[model samples]
Target: MVQRQQVVMFEIKKASEAEIAERGDLADKVADALARAGFAVHRDVNDASGALGAMAWADPADDSGGGVFVRWLIDPAFSRAAVQSVQQGDVESAAFKHFSTVTEQMYAALLAILTSAGFQSEDADDDMSPYTIRVKG
Candidate 1:
């Protein structure tokens, strides 16, 4: 019964030109693998001047008849609690809790998305690390 949702932010890692060439088909590989694994993910490769990042988004609104009940529960919970307030519509939310269950599991989701894309990552975060990436449109 859901219609729309927001994608969480993600980052790039270990992707150099030589690496992409060696794994030239990685972009398609990443996208397809994620889809098959039940995450409707998207990938991006970008660079401006000397800065760069690779990012992806999983379809947070998917309801593909799996009936597992967990993803169904998690989707609306996250959107209502974390995403809806920030979509520039009206209500403003408070600061994100980087250590909460939502953020913690989101980190796991990011790991899954990135690894599928052939990016090797240790992908750690302390209090000093960013809480969310906010992948640009």
Candidate 2:
């Protein structure tokens, strides 16, 4: 199988005025954590005219899952891979496990980083919800 790169993203939402003023510091802390994990990280501010707050992307790790799969599920580009995985059954589960593991790791690291920095992080549990986006913590 040809390995495909994956990128996992998370958004940091400002819960209060204090958090808003310290956006740069927060981004630095996040990037530091991601960088240490061997991922090339990038930070974007006011994405979509502040509707999405700040966004971060980490380079793909081995066998990780990215939005590309879900985004292109209907496209022919993914049909071959998807069909093969469906035939095997376990491939999807294995991929999800890998994604969850990395996500949890990053989530824990970010939680600790944010809390230590005196920022109150949200945990609404909805990825598309207005609440802050966390990996899984």
TM-score of each candidate structure, all chains considered together: 0.33, 0.36
Top-lDDT candidate index: 2
* Native-referenced Cα lDDT, model 1: 0.40
Summarize candidate 1's per-residue lDDT along 14-63 as a digit string, tens digits: 34455444343544554455466676443433222222122332322223
Mind sharing the TM-score for model 1? 0.33
Taken over the whole model, the C-alpha lDDT of each candidate is 0.40, 0.41
Candidate 1, superposed: residue stretches over 4 Å from native: 1-18, 45-54, 57-100, 110-121, 124-137
Return the lDDT, model 1, position 68: 9
Stretches of candidate 2 above 4 Å error? 1-41, 45-92, 129-137
Scored against the true structure, residue 11 in model 2 reaches a CA lDDT of: 58
